[model samples]
Target: LNGFRRTPRPLIRAEYQHWAVYVGEGHVIHLAPPCDLMVALSFYFFLYNVRATVKKGKLYVVVGNNDYRINNILDEKYEPRPIQEIVQDAHGLLGKELPYSVLTRHCEHFVTELRYGKPQSCQVQLR
Candidate 1:
């Protein structure tokens, strides 16, 4: 699979998996914590009145180009959509602001949605 390394916080390393869809040519699309002003500002205003810290995120289409090493792949029991459709779906989300929730919507959910046409997070389900 083409994705980011599953580098969680040291204390919770085994508790999560960051996922991304392999869109060919060493590129992948995944949701991640906000890394720039456009996303941070949007989430800040969106959560203005909320008591929780505004840690918003967005979807990124990155050209990893062998930055990550391949490990074993988990075979999810769903048939993936056509490669072209999945690639299109992933590309369609590039740079979009997304409401990210560890327990509801995360990286795994993003990739699964593109591949299987349904959002599902194994990490959340196992919790």
Candidate 2:
């Protein structure tokens, strides 16, 4: 149920609303750009030396923190799928590599797919 709020960062605009699947226990699954290995190399050369590259992004299970919060704007008309189905759908994509596109494939699409069995992005559709 996580959604985006106002932020100054150029990457996060007002029109955008990020989404994630709440897998309970304060954990969430969503798609995001891979962590910068170059940055890790500079900070922890010895301990964190692993080579990994992603074309766009990957599904990640993360904790609910300051990064994700609820937004006022959401589709009230939408209904959620069964909890078991949603959980299974989210787990099925765990650690899978997914190409990300702001218009075609984004966080909204990911969460919607898990909850509705179809990939969709209201923001992109609105535009």
Candidate 3:
């Protein structure tokens, strides 16, 4: 926990954020980026797709929690996915390379894809 910090583009004032997927043990899977934060933030309109990787006990400084899916279960619009399949799908991606993108395939997209079977990000207009 000491060395593992939040891993994401530190755009605290920006509209987008990153979340890590805890894949059991002491490891976490997050997008490591094909480019740096300066490049992504300096050129806001440019498209970037990075490679997702598994980092053992590593995270960057990030804020906020994804409670909508976990706490919004009482909502009628919240359709929960099966935990067994989600876990299975998540584990299945442990050692594989994944396509990561800022707008199209972000950290939120990874979480949604694993838990809900569809990758979705709300921070950026996907279209």
lDDT of each: 0.52, 0.52, 0.49
Which pairs of residues collide in candidate 2?
A: none
Model 3 pairs in collision? 5-59, 5-60, 6-59, 6-60, 7-60
lDDT of 3 at 100: 62
Which residue pairs collide, candidate 1? Answer: none
TM-score of candidate 2 versus the correct structure, residues matched by position: 0.58
Give all TM-scores, in the order shown: 0.60, 0.58, 0.58
Error of 2 at 19 (Å): 1.3
Number of the top candidate by TM-score? 1
Predictions ranked by TM-score, top down?
A: 1, 3, 2
**Residues 1-127, candidate 1, lDDT per residue (tens digit)?**
4432332321122324556565556455667645333234433354332121222222232322223333223345776677788777677777776766555556666667777777876666776
Which candidate, 1 or 3, has the higher lDDT? Answer: 1
Error of 3 at 47 (Å): 3.2
Evaluate model 1: give its lDDT: 0.52
> Which candidate would rank higher by TM-score, 1 or 2?
1
Model 3 C-alpha lDDT versus the unseen true structure = 0.49
